[model samples]
Target: MSEQSKSPQAPDRTPRVVIAGAGMAGVQTAVALREQGWRGAITLLGDEPHQPYDRPPLSKAVLLGKADGATLDVDFPGLGIDLRLGCRATALRPADRLVETDQGPVRYDYAVLATGAAPVRLPGTEGLSGVHLLRTLDDAERLRPELAGRRRIVVVGAGWIGAEFATAAREAGCEVTVVEAADRPLAGALPPEVARYMAGWYGDAGAELRTGVAVASVAPGAVTLADGTVLPADTVVVGIGARPATAWLAGSGVALSPVDGSVLADERLHTSVPGVYAVGDCASFPSARYGTRLLVHHWDNALQGPRAVAENIARGEAEGVVYDPVPYFWSEQFGRFVQYAGYHGDADELVWRGDPAGAAWSVLWLRRADGPDAVAGAGRLVALLAVGRPRDLAQGRRLIERGALLDRERAADATVPLKAAVR
Candidate 1:
């Protein structure tokens, strides 16, 4: 082949960043790229046909039909983002820098894995009628009518989603019964002393909360317990848990955590593979602040991670910024405003600000002490949870970030400001 006869070189195309999911993390990544001064071609792919929306509302307002939808207020065209709906990425070919989607192969200069998570389903209930999950817009829409009909709902799992869904169902006049296999609500999340305080919220809302009771089987119109006790259920809402949607990256040269299947990103949100990054529920990063690997599945993590990923992408690898945030999240359930900040371990010294049975109370987790700043044998604030006390949460979150040591006696005084309690 003569040099002159050789195929003409392909035209130089604009550099592109392909985002795999259109959830909060993916959408924000595309937006943040522009904000971070990345003037490149951005292509975002979403499996759902509807506009990308918030997930938290799916369990609350959307489930009760109080709102039509919770679509994000981002303008894709205005932002120069090519948003492709109903196009799911099936595989990632790192060698070719191509993402194989259900639609077609999409080329990318860089790729972001923000596919979020998939809710864990009950065994043998894939196609069973009256069984549903509240993870997506369509899922919420399908469940709205069910809740509006005032059906007897049996929610499996007394986790955050279960409690929130029960709140919505009860608000809609449904007979809500939440069954948990553990000994208490949020056994997987909070310590028993704290979680025990929440168990009363369900019964107060007229919903039967059955803890330490395993579901032997789940069928339409009923849920059978391990003890052979059958609870009448018109509908079954499964909120057991969710696993990161990182299975598509298998063999794509991305390291995934065996514990949770999340992409094992470094401190800078960059994955094992060059020119590729991961964020949101699909990714777990080492938290030097917490001294452990953190897998955050909440909206806040999904909201905060993209900014770091975007900034790192805009700046070259050498100048990338580190991502180590003080993780925060809030929950509105059981007619109370609940907030939590920082990470706490069972070994932490537990301090009560007020009576747990009271309508408004807060609990602070202090590090076990012998430090110079130790007060009452506790050192530094590790974590804090407040029920109907936004002030404590707001002030304590900052203290946790600053690693402040709280004067135990002052912090235990419900009237004292958390900042004042800092030693």
Candidate 2:
């Protein structure tokens, strides 16, 4: 037997494993542990009083009253995990491997830093009564009433939340305006051409798109721009960005990425410190596909990372499965169902598979001019961006990976279905 197999298994003794931040990431960790046949006692620490819930529907269905907060309740009882809700994790001491919470200090045999992230609020816009951010159930609940009447809503960022909130505001019969510092929407993720197509979406949906504008300050019923233009608004929803909630790990001997405040984890999701693993939005791991340390904050990543960590923690290693996903995210905004799978960083060419002027459309991003036949990374198809046709995304993803040469003329022709062009 290998030395690892011969080593005596760690005494179970109902090993107490403590997880902080009871969002999707935290709850998924506990559930994944049980699924991995881990017999350790699991305790979840969260700042919210409610049980673990899904967060994506908050700005969309929840705000529309079609969905309620309770609908997001995760079945933790079914997984045999003790949930310590309504409490915040204050600190972590690696020297003693303990987590300090508002209730008391919980000694941990293994610690999972799934603290997730905090919504970045635009500075100089604080203390405003009507300003809101969607990070927790409380934030969503507090802003729920503001969407009732015909209110003037100003979304401070043109990213996912801003676009989604703008959509919701327009649905609520409110006038909406989106402010983005970049030239177009989703600039950080999507290419310029793709973003321009999305920019037209806000206008078509009756929401103003104030691109290349920066917020100077915010006051009651108005957002002042850098150019001194005051946009009137009854509610200001800030979705500028988010920073990883790693303040508690400041001196905890864990390596954290200084760029976005994300934790640095190896292929096993193990941190530099032994027995300390980080996952979800708090972790930046090297991706074999992207060839970079990717920090994906989507729901799928959190749901997948814990299983890898649990198996590794229990048996010292987990092969065949790691936390590298293709990176997919979907947003429902302005009556447009937007979905993008795969990353398209610095793509040189973009081909529209459908009509951008129409409600349902999709775009294929390529790194070079040749074709989707081009290999990914150096010069290949990297992302499938679809606004309405969700099925096209799946087909496009498959063709792009196999380096299939697409008929440039008919491939992007809206009249032809993507699958039909495959052969």
Candidate 3:
């Protein structure tokens, strides 16, 4: 008999998808898959015992006691998702298509890695009481009482998390001091000239902003600067940064980014492993539009990346779905609503909108191009940072997606609507 004639017909069965994390990305992936009409089995695994929750609130509402909890508004049982809370995925066995968890190895037809990121802890601060890292509900909860007591807080790193934490600490009547190793606040995220204006917000909020200061060591009640400056603190919050939580994928044959250990996912969110996909903070996807691989660790990325992942999984490669997105994120700090959209690189031209020292202002970043029309090319809006200017951010985001060429003077005019600036 011919090989084709001898082949047995395979029985049709529902696909099983195992998601390794139960944070926003993991939960959203499961929800999106179901909403996309995938009647497959979904096993959502999380290391935390608490129910899946939104993380953004952990820094704002939850920390300020404005909200009780950030638990996600999802009925896991009703959705028929296998919500495995408090279960840790120890390793990935790609050869057998199984996720080795503390509970047991769970088999899957396809697996989605949404492990997310872990907060970078301050060195030599381990086992020290009153030191915390805010990345989860438990971390926020632990810090809540400290804030309620109106303790003196020394926040390390003047990044988003640190600024937000300081805002909350000040609101809670705590003495706040933000220490950054860089020369200005948001040094890693914004230009010094832009970040210089933001530094004033800390002082306006009654928090001391100390930049270009390195922490030599962190103790229970104080942080010692490299210059031997001892900053008194009843509580210390480390907000330096976070790294992708992909240590479990070691030896699993999954290709991880050498830069940040993020899973190297394609434009479609598929990992090096044939049957596996990665999304959110734990995954870095290449953006053909930006000509770079972006590892966006924000709520928007988590919310948006899932749609592409789910579609590709459901419709397959023929769908040609890509996960390239205009990166957007917002932060509430010093009584200001700060929003940013799109990717910006060194080559992007920075255009100022309105007075930076004023209560409301925005910054437009245009992509640089060469040629006779270089001036017009440089006016192509690619990214925007709006401080207390939501309309600018809202309009700028749309214009960026449209690849709108803007007039520099009109784009920088606070009186003009960003959409109208496009020529």
Candidate 4:
């Protein structure tokens, strides 16, 4: 049998590709496939009844009521893909190359798992209508009315969602109390100094920031602290974090990471099984910056990863480019726009470009020292974190790996471009 003859010939029909989860990654995958001239029948399965929409805005604009939830509509029919909304995908059988959903079994030549993550609900708080989690448009819609009553809103966990919710609650005239077991906000992502600066933001925003305190329990009227101190709350918003929605993949031969239950993928986002790929919040791949497998649950990664996967899926091993874009994320909290680009886990030194106490400042993390204040090469400015400075983030992203020690006097000028700090 020759190379082409040894294999059973594929049917002379458009390849059927079923994508589970209609989030950003899945929708974009469908769009990219069609745009790449993939004539295959694409079926997008979403557990939610609504169309795909940008999720980042949910915690900020949607919660603040500055944007309506209904305005979120991703044109699916315009892309000529079958949209199966409000349906759940039950299982995947790689041997059969078919996905079992509530509607029926969907056989496919290729399948994508962009299932995304599920909000972690605090145990014992279920059935309490006041308790909420912000992961979906519907979740934001349900919690908006509670914001208008000036209620005491207890935000559990001080991660990005918690901080954003605290900001929105304060804007809604509600008393916001943030409880975090960590010593500072964003302790997992930012340094202690930077985290402390953010801790002060809650107080400055007129919201209570309680650090190093574990949430013992949530009652109807209050949140009980670890020390038995009760914080009155009419609404408790849980932002503890998210776990991958890979429950359906159990016993399906797809390897998932034990660390966080994320699907393990190579640079091309291919799972252990061939012909199937994973991306977005559900998958983790080795990152050159961190030198280990990392799970980046950000908007840009979800939006951009599909193109790489689509090319690989369409052309197989002939596709050369591996998915290795710089990781970036942003947040709006306490009337400030915080943006971070690159990863700083291994940075040797952290330098502030501006006064932290001032209205605007950005910090650049340099991995290597090229003499006194010069660091160059890739991964040098492994990460740049900025507060209230979007343009600085844009400039710093380009300056990263440039090996230039920032001059505070020059940086304070406010006239220097972020990339020109050293140049």
Total clashing pairs in model 4:
2
Output the number of the lDDT-best candidate: 1
Between the candidate structures 1 and 4, which one is better when assessed by TM-score?
1
lDDT for each residue of candidate 4 in 1-423, tens digit (9 for 90 to 100): 111233448643568778999998898888888777777788899999876787988998898789886433556778779888887889999998878887767777889999999988898988887899999999899888889778889999999999999998999999888999999998888889888888899999999889998999888888899989999888999999899999999988999998899999898888898788998999988876457787989988898789888887776757534887678889988888899987777345677767888879888776654575453432255678888888988877766534445554454455677565563
lDDT of each residue in 133-232, candidate 2, tens digit only: 9877788887778888678888888988888888888888888889999999988888776788789888988988999989999998889999999999
- What lDDT does model 4 reach? 0.82
**Poorest 10 consecutive residues of model 4 by lDDT?**
1-10
TM-scores vs. true structure, each candidate: 0.96, 0.89, 0.96, 0.91
Computed on alpha carbons, the lDDT of every model, listed in order, comes to 0.91, 0.79, 0.90, 0.82
Question: What is the per-residue lDDT of model 1 for residues 1-423, given as tens digits with 9 covering 90 to 100?
Answer: 211134338533679899999999999999999999999899999999999999988888888888999999999999999999999999999998888898877778899999999999989889999999889999999999999899999999999999999999999999999999999999987999999999999999999999998989988789999989999988999999999998888899999998999999999999998899999999999999889999998889998899999999998778878999888888999899999889998789889998999899999998856655345644689899999999999999999999888888888999999899877
Note the residue pairs that clash in candidate 4: 375-403, 376-403
Residue 280's lDDT within candidate 3 is 91
Give the lDDT of residue 105 in candidate 1. 78
Top candidate, metric TM-score: 1
Ranking by TM-score: 1, 3, 4, 2
Give the Å error, residue 82, model 2: 1.0
